[model samples]
Target: MMPNTTTLLISAGLLLARPISTLAQTTDPNVDNADTPFIQNIRPDRPGQTVTTNMLHPGQVQLETGILRFDPTDASWGTRRTLSSALLRVGFFNHIELRASQGYLHPLPGTSVFNEANPTVGPAGFTPLTVGAKFLASTNQDARSQVVLLTEMTLRTGDASFLNKAYEPAIRLLVSQQLGARYGLEANVGFRQRGFQAADTKLGQYLGTLALNGPLGGNFGFFTEAYTTWQRSTRFLPGLTSGLYWRPLPGLRLDVTAGQQFGNLGTGFTLGGGLSVRLPK
Candidate 1:
């Protein structure tokens, strides 16, 4: 005997209702109030907002020194080099900051051919100086989100005998979001225009970065970041960085980072550290 279609439909309906009945039993009444300010305050929609304002005050000064190495895999095309550098940065106001850096770049002797038919090999050295600024467009207090607009210009002001003097102007937009009381995420996207003799021949570069930071223990915090740059060459250079920051006082901090570079023009690892001091209003 064939089963009745009406009876079969009723049986299927009961089977679907069982899951709904179980869900209703497991649901908590407190879950409905989960959107309270107490919860939202701890997990702000933006980073650098929940933290006390004194953490990043105006009239701050920071200093950093480190070593960077660039090793080209194709020795015939480029060279391996190291740079020792120092950076000094100052915050004039809540919205503006200035930075200056200088470094000695030493290139290891390598084989290269200006003309593929003729091979040339030599050692080279140069000093590079770079100055830049970062501007904050929207502060953490803003209703929308934390947004920063940054513009920087790096110029090689030292002797150009070994390296061509050049200038790079870059603009970036940065935004951050707070995940929890101690965790935050940030991202930046930028475009750089190169200036100098070969500037006309090469296209500007595009840069993108993402980072995460959070308090670790007592007064220390951890940070990690990944960045990539796209230039005229089809190949892209990428870098990864990990760092820790220590805050001894309300407006002072020390940070150290280590990372490696990867791609056609970048090779090897880098270690760096910096100190920042912020003044009260």
Candidate 2:
């Protein structure tokens, strides 16, 4: 006599339900706790580590190099030039950093003749050097907010006979906040002094910039910024700048930027690229 199909089906169903019965038996609080990791170790909202430096720790360093080009709208009034620079930054304390940059300037041929030159008929050759410091004033971990202050001075290092031999200084304030898990916003305001001949000496220029950063994918991110500058002279020329940044490694960064002069005093286009490498903490 062959076995009944109904009986065989019932036996198979019971076999299939054995795992469910086992799971039900293992659902006791004591057994579950014994098998699972501790709540503290598995907490989902635990805060992450912060990036910091200590006196005992080796100071962090960063090196950057870039090339910049200035294109004048009226070639007769202003000249075209290329500048190359290397910047070095070192952390002195957790909240402070020092930066130094030195560069060479090369004026393009036929771009130096000033249309309205009297005694100074053409553009001058000059090497530029700058030194600066940044200080972190405040930071909040819960809010993901920070404030920083920066100041710098730039000096001309070329022949005084050929270039404007003076120093320019600037100060800036920066505020940054994390907008979301992978997005950040930054705002900056600054003042810059231009140094030149007695007739061309100008007061400080006011500047502002807004920046945004977001993650593009795993370990990849994107950044963009827009900036505006206002000169206080009677000429009334404002400038606008925009740029993008890319990071391909933990301590490496690349930036590309373009800017144009606005208003009457001077009009020009600027193109530049920068690379930075950060040292291990």
Candidate 3:
């Protein structure tokens, strides 16, 4: 019989639990360090909502982008679409990077550009800008554990339809624990102000996300994730997503994902596909 996802997760955890001493005995230091490539593999923050803990090497730049479609519970609102959801990252000093993201969400009737119905909404308009930075706080080589911190601020410059008309700030703590050699587990927690208005300023939205990802074979990999958002007065709004990824070259990756959101007011599903490219300086 085929095993369920829970069973598979449990099995992977067990595999990752093997004694560290046993793993150490199999390592050859010289062999492991013999080959160091000029450019590292591209690490993307796509196919899922949870941002990864991996940081780019110094002097490297990366662009990750894709298209997305969301089917809302209310058919009258129509399927919301994004033509170019993109994030650009530039590595600066060691363990630090600059980041920015922008996307165009097709205008919808009677719906705010960013509504509670969909948590995956992206920033729109040419003027409004969302900028951020990431820092690698700490790392443990033996356990392959990483802790990263991110801070972002959205400027209130943009088209009226797309502007929240205020400074929106956010922060998140991201972590990644490698399970064995092929699998990894990641988690994130954060909070952000959606708007500067009185109603939106009263309570910030909190986010929590967990994900498991690993390789399937030679050039293919997969990931499954669960994420949620909540406020002081509201229940948790959760979602699930899974997808496959392929690497056709050393610095390029392509991926596709599908998922659904669950909420009290309404529910919806999302579909997306994108690519990431890393440029070496």
Candidate 4:
């Protein structure tokens, strides 16, 4: 099992800092000589809604984009489609990074765009802009484990009819552990407050995720995950997703995933793929 990074890092950082801080208070010339070389940190998003606990090195940039994403609509209109940048990450110093995302919506109404049960129900628009920050609290290369925290704000700047027109915010804590050279485990827990108006803020969703990922061979990998949610009226909703990923060259990855909800209220399936590229600082 991989080491628990958040726990270890908090400990290690304190130990690493005590001496340095003590030296800083002195006139020691060697205090400035503690430059540790950096090892490569590579983590990509896509193929799952659960983000991983990894951060780019300072000055690095990563693009996570979807070529085409589609979901079967219960409505007779057809499948909803989109082409979008799911996320972009840029690393600065102090184990922090900037993130941005937007998706173009093209909803194909099965019979009508409005939910027949409730004419008041509609869909989100072509463009939903989300901006966030990701912080790496800890990483342990020897143990191959990491921990990360991410927070995002969804801006209601898209087509008003397609959006909730309210600011939605979310936060997630991610943990990853490498079981072996061929196997790994990850888990996530998060909360999102969505569709709130002015002072009516409430917990809209409670999320839990777990996954097992392993390599298929060189440059090829696969992962299967179960994502669960607890909501107000629906109570509990469960979903499963699986995908394969390939790397044809260094710093580039491609992935395809399909997901479906499971329950009496379950409806259609979702299919999407993503491409990611990393650029060095």
Per-prediction TM-score: 0.62, 0.63, 0.75, 0.73
Number of the candidate with higher TM-score, 2 or 4: 4
What RMSD does each model have against the real structure?
Answer: 12.0, 14.5, 12.5, 11.2
The best candidate in terms of lDDT: 3
Per-residue lDDT over 1-281 for candidate 3, one digit per residue giving the tens place of the 0 to 100 score: 35688899888888877865567755733233212221134558776779888787778899998887886554544556444588999988867889998776565555456545663443344546789999888842223677899999988766555434677889999998766555778899988896657787558888899999887888788889999988888888899999998987768899999998998443567888999998872
Cα lDDT of model 4 by residue, 5-72, tens digit: 78788899988998888767665422322221112323476667678765776788998888555553
lDDT of 1: 0.58
Kindly indicate the candidate among 2 and 3 with the higher TM-score: 3
- Clashes in predicted model 2: 0
Per-residue alpha-carbon lDDT of candidate 2 for residues 96-148, written as tens digits (9 for 90 to 100) = 77878776655556555334454444444545677888777764212346677
Name model 2 segments beyond 4 Å from true.
1-58, 73-79, 109-126, 139-143, 159-162, 194-202, 218-220, 234-240
Each model's C-alpha lDDT?
0.58, 0.57, 0.75, 0.69
List the candidate 3 regions with Cα displacement exceeding 4 Å. 1-40, 72-79, 107-127, 139-143, 195-201, 265-267
Better of 1 and 4 by lDDT: 4
Give the distance in Å from residue 31's predicted Cα in candidate 1 to where it truly belongs: 24
When 1 and 3 are scored with lDDT, the better candidate is 3
Clashes per model (N, Cα, C within 3 A)? 0, 0, 0, 6
Task: Show pairs that collide, candidate 2.
Answer: none
In model 4, which regions exceed 4 Å deviation? Answer: 1-42, 67-83, 107-125, 139-143, 195-203, 264-267
Model 2 alpha-carbon miss at residue 231, Å: 3.3
lDDT of 1 by residue, 111-192 (tens): 3423335444322444556676766666443222366666677776764433445687767787766454456677888877
